[model samples]
Target: MSQIVVLDTNVLLHDPQAIFAYPKDEIVIPAIVLEEIDSKKRLADELGRNARSVSRLLDKIKEEGKLHSGIKLPNGSIIRVELNHRNFTQVQDLFGEITNDHRIIAVAMNYHVEQQALPEQERKQVVLVSKDVLMRIKADVLGLPAKDYISDPHLQADDRYNGYFTLHVHPSIIDEFYTYRYLMVHNLGLRHQLNPHEFVILKDELGTTKSALLKVNANATKLEPLFLSNDPVWGITARNAQQRMALELLMNDEIPLVTLTGKAGTGKTLLALAAGLLKVEDEHKYKKLLIARPVVPMGKDIGYLPGEKEEKLRPWMQPIYDNLEYLFDTKKSGDIDKILMGLGSIHVEALTYIRGRSIPGQFIIIDEAQNLTSHEIKTIVSRVGEGSKIVLVGDPEQIDHPYLDSMSNGLTYVVERFKQEGISGHIALEKGERSKLAQLAADLL
Candidate 1:
């Protein structure tokens, strides 16, 4: 049976291509949704961009056929703009208001009644698809089937890749790896498949303290010893195995993309900065170190602050400056600024200004990346030019974006999508190293 999927305004704003997601089903865009999209198209943000894209898509679709009547989509499904849903008595009685959400729900309810009035064999299934939780609830209360429009598959917090695994093997294998510095993949007796650049802690089957740190090659065909650094980068050193694994990937120029995820105080930002500094300043692998992050407000926006662009960005980029001060060992209040001026190799900017420019020969670090959408991440990654590497560091659990969550954030999306690529690596830090109080708050609070 053909299905009628009514899309909500949030779905379209979240992803303009949502209309094409349901290829096998008929798409219904209520007239109210278009109005909502129109209201948001003038804003200056990612939502506005999506709204404009959706408008363009609708305009192009209009040329194919009249949107009021049924129009055949590329996938052989029908699409129609619903403009005749005037009856809202049922929704008004249930919700006590003819709000925009209720109006959209009323359209779905109208479709449901129409389908129900038809013969059972010829009736179509009507489902209201929305990204809003309360909207879906309201639809369900009105005897309409509603669901979340999930485009990407979600990974549970515990099921996410932690970059390193503990493998139980014989003591002899550990000895062989220590001596040869390389181990065969078959000899690990592994049950689970490992991705490229995945770290493994090989332990003896007897549960002794004997263990070896190894990393999977790009092809996942061989295991090699991790590149353990004796010297510290700036003043920071890897305090744990996971940190060590993250450092190896961060410093390796062969890996073009690296994602680091962890709770607050996991040393994600510190490690990334340390590695980026080492590669950019010490080794001169890249021309400069470019750091950018999404400017997601904590409680409210900083627009009302008393300054220009740099002043407005100071509050959002303070954390990055804090790490820089610590790494540069700024003894006085303004010592860090002097050091940065002398180096002239590091640039810190907002993610908003990074579009449409190709970045080449630079080490880019995108902190607080969980606040970005998947589309924003795609845009940032595509800007990488030759001889450049980008590091995305964020705590998925600590997202500040209202429309994003741990599983739906860009950090997790890139982690899951790039795990199989040889040029990419990821590590989820487990332990927190910020401070005792902060770590306790992250764990117990």
Candidate 2:
């Protein structure tokens, strides 16, 4: 059965094509939604893009018929823009205010009341959908069926990468760790189900003789490198269990998308850049190393950022340069730039130019991915061509987007959805590895 759904302003602002999201259903946009869109049209960043998109969508719909009446969408759905009417009194009675959200709720309430007058089977179909939790709650209080927009239907946190494994070995293997330089457990042979970034602690047949940790790559090759970095490159190293797992994920080429979460100074960016450099410059796994982060401000854009493309990107990409300089032990800022130029294969770009472009044979890293909407993230990830590995690193808890929470942020959503797929992998780095004070702050404050 098709449902009658009234989209609140937040839903429209969050996804301009929300009308088409509910296929085969009647979509209604309250008049107040337009007013709210108008107020936000002049803003900047994703919200502004949505406002403009909504305007364009409504304009395209208007070509079909008068919006106050009804129009048929190309997807075989009906859409109508609601106008004030006597039915609105029921809304006023319920909300007792003409606030914008309430006004939009009024349109949905009127639609529900109209449905109630229909046949019994038809009366169970109207729902008011909004991205705003408070508005959804208010709709329920007013006796109207409501739901939040389902941006991600597949999310499983319990199945996320835990980064540990167990290997059952013969009791004789106990001597292998201390006596032999390495162990080739030929008995475990090829086709073993160890994932690319998986780590294992080999235990004796008696389970008490000796134990040594090992890592498995995609080729099913086992390498038992030192468990920790001895030189402590870039003044950063795994400081906690979560961070140690995160390091394993970052260093492993098999795990394409490594998701890290922590407060500031967790060394997320530093570690990601270091691993990217190692793979691109040292290992030659990819043609290039690409780094990009969303340009979204907390509430708005920087208005008119000065200079050319590289100059304009400096303010935002400066943090990356700082990390690179620290990693390379370069005293001059230009020294890091010279090194990047000498490398020639590495490139830093802005996210704005990434859309619709196919990037193949590259190690792509997206920082601050939590700032992106699910749709935006889809657009970015879909651009990954053959032989390309894209890593999305972000802290879900620090979302600047108004409509996204930790659960809905692109990083968390991707981690939850792809954790089960063997081709994809995720790790939630919980510990701060930047410094003693930084780690202390991440835990205490």
RMSD of each: 2.4, 6.0
Would you estimate the TM-scores of all the predictions? 0.92, 0.70
CA lDDT, every model vs. true structure: 0.89, 0.74
- The residue-by-residue lDDT of candidate 1 on 271-349, one tens digit each, is 9999989888889999999999888887668777778998998889999999999898778887877788899999899
The digit string of per-residue lDDT tens for model 2 on 119-197 reads: 8975747799987888989888888889877665454445445445566777676466557645554546535455555
Model 1 whole-model lDDT (C-alpha atoms): 0.89
Point out where model 1 deviates above 4 Å. 113-124, 154-159, 186-192, 299-302
Error of 2 at 383 (Å): 3.0
**By TM-score, how accurate is candidate 2?**
0.70
Which pairs clash in the backbone of model 2? none
